[model samples]
Target: MDIRKLDDRLSVAPQITPAEVTEAAALGFRAIICNRPDGEAPGQPTFEEIERAAKAAGLEARLIPVASGGLPPTQAVAEMARALDELPGPVLAFCRSGTRSTILWALAQAGRRPAAQIVAAAREAGYDIAPLAPLLETAA
Candidate 1:
């Protein structure tokens, strides 16, 4: 897994496999958030499968699948916020390319930090977050 730290509490990774859960736990990630929709790519394990593995590894797991080009639902954002608030750090989230996960994480953190800072952080990490500006504005 190519994990990128978003903050002290959160990180993002490319798609991860079930076997990676143990390593993630070992790395001190207390929770796993899946931002990729199931069946987006052939041969990818379902979110439930990953969640089961994470749980077995003693890490909390949450699935808030985000469709590309779609705004994240309020309920999904709330769920992510709740996970961040409740789960111990560091929390690891993944998607096909990690873009969507980063987007959602940034949006969820909107009110907690300046919007430009968040966008700049994402950009420095190699994620283009221009599309989320509207949502971030609304979030603020």
Candidate 2:
């Protein structure tokens, strides 16, 4: 898993295997947030598999799957925000390439964090967040 830390409490990553969930717990992650919908790819592990692994590792987990290519829906952002508020940190959130997970985090953080700070954080983590500038600005 190519885990990219966005901050002290949250990290975004490309899809992780069930085994990696165990590793994540070992790395001090207290929760897992799955942002990828199952079956988006042919061989990716399902959320249930990850959840089971998380449970076995004594970590909380939640699935707020976002569709592959688009701005996350308002409800999805709301759910993500709730998860961020409630899940024990540090949380590991994953999607196909980590973009969706990052996007959801960015949107959810809007109005709470400055747009520039959010964009800079994602960019520093290797995501090109230029496309989100306008949305991030207005979201605040």
Task: Give the candidate number with the greatest lDDT.
Answer: 2
Number of clashing pairs, model 2?
0
List of clashing residue pairs for candidate 1: none
Off by over 4 Å in 1: none
Off by over 4 Å in 2: none
- Kindly list the per-residue Cα lDDT of model 1 for residues 1-140, writing each as its tens digit: 79888888889999999999889998889999998899999999899899999989999998888887777788878888888898888999999988888888888898888888888888877898977777777778
The true-structure Cα RMSD of candidate 2 reads 0.7
Question: How do the predictions measure up, each by TM-score?
Answer: 0.90, 0.98
lDDT of 2 by residue, 70-109 (tens): 7889999999999999999999999999999999999998
Candidate 1 TM-score over all chains jointly: 0.90
Model 1 residue 108 CA deviation in Å: 0.8
* Shift in Å, residue 7, candidate 1: 0.8
